[model samples]
Target: MAEITASAVKELRERSGAGMMDCKKALTETGGDLEAASDWLRSKGLAAAAKKSSRTAAEGLVGVAVAGTKGVAIEVNSQTDFVAKNEIFQGFVREVTGIALEKGDDIDALKASPMAQGGTVEEVLTANIATIGENQVLRRAKAVSVSQGAVIPYVHNAAAPGLGKIGVLVALESDAGVDVLEPLGKQIAMHVAAAFPLALDENGLDQDTLERERAIATEKAAESGKPADIIAKMVEGTVRKFAKENSLLNQLFVMDGKTPVSEVVAKAAKDAGATIKLTDYVRFQLGEGIEKEESDFAAEVAATAGLTK
Candidate 1:
């Protein structure tokens, strides 16, 4: 059996959200294999879908860029939040975002694309990690574009130009000039930041999400002592309400708090005397789903000193 180290157990605990002893046992049982240990925890129902298996659990910036009718959002992660404020780190994020605009959002392509400073993006990132004295990763990049309209980018409480905790891009396809579309796009982006819509429209929402909602509604409706037919109607109505609330187009505008987003777009088109369609959007909130490890310093000291068993 391979010896399990403290750092290995700590990592496993963070990844699986399991107890310390459970993590140590899993690592020991798996001979210090992270993946197999995660599998072991999952088999024992300690985690949900190997939460930390391929996810980046770090702090950094979600940088966004918009040019013409295209926009891109990229997540660059660092081991500590301090690196987010570093000049070199911010510069890398800005350059990578611009490169993403030109080279497109395919991460591999963006990494291989030229950098104004020196070598490829991947090379610069590697150099930064060494110089910055911390681990970092270019986690994800995505782009949205329209044929003949404007792509607007918004950074909530922006730390700098296009970098912030939450970055949003709204793609509007319209015959209206940018002068008119830009404000609309910005407002839509703001709404997205607040509403946190799951999809741009009902069709865009995945079946799995709808199914989960349906299951929850079914359980709730069963407690009402309602008949079979009425219970069915209750579940259907509940799901429809969920779809309307969670889908961007059907969701009420956050500004007015009443008008559906689709209606808002229609009204904008009527006022501008040009067709306006909210085609797509992207919202990246930094470290949104990744769980961070919160340490108990006192407990750690005691454990280190073998004062607690």
Candidate 2:
């Protein structure tokens, strides 16, 4: 039997949102495998599906820039939120976002690209770290563009003009003019920020995610003592529901809370007397997927003083 450590229990609790004892027991039952423990909790109806986005604790800003029909979103991480507020840090993020808009979102390529001021993007970042006196990273960038329509950008909880905690870009392919596209695109971008859709459509949902949802649903259905065919149908329905809830096009619009996003776009196109298609979108939330270590200040201080915690 594998030993389940306190840190393992803490991690399982964070991942599954189960109680301490429940998480500990799940870890024990699953031989201390974090992923398996999560499944165990979900199967027992002790926890909801884990959402990676909720784990965000890193301090940073997500910057956005746009040119005609093209937009880019970038994330720059810092060791502390105080650093994220610094003018120097924000300026670097904004400038690098512009470079990404021009070049592309490849991390290495963007880092290697020359900055408008002087040195390469990576060099500027290094200089900023020394000047700001905190460690930082050029985490990631994503670009979205359309052949003809408007690409709109929005920042949520903005720290500056184009820098914020969440950056979103919506690419619309249509014959509609900016007068029609800009407002609509911005609304959709805001939706992307608030809704946090996993993908643009059903086809874009990850297979692994779907399988995991299916497994949970199967375990849940089996608990009802239903027949095999009924259990299978129940599992399929649950998976389909999960897809509809997480897919951008299928999700109900946050604005109206009733109309599907696809319907919203279609209605806007009808009103504009033109064709509108949502081609692509980029939603960058700062620190998403990067786990920040949780520290106990009291415990550390006690240990440093050579006292028992």
TM-score (all chains, Cα) for each model: 0.78, 0.78
User: How many collisions per candidate?
Assistant: 0, 0
The TM-score, computed over Cα atoms with residue i paired to residue i, of candidate 1 is 0.78
Estimate, for each residue in 1-309, the C-alpha lDDT of model 2 and write its tens digit: 999999999988877766577688888899999999988877765554232223333788999999998999999888789987798888888889888999999999998899888978876775565466566788888998888998999999999999999999999999999999999999999999999999999999999999999999999999999999999999999999999999999999999899999999999999999999998999999889888878788987998799963
lDDT of 1: 0.87
lDDT of 1 at 234: 97
Model 2, residue pairs in steric clash: none
RMSD of each: 10.1, 15.3
Give per-residue lDDT, candidate 2, residue 199: 99
lDDT of 1 by residue, 177-255 (tens): 9899999999999999999999999889999999999999999999999999999999999999999899999999999
The lowest-lDDT stretch of 10 consecutive residues in candidate 2 is 48-57
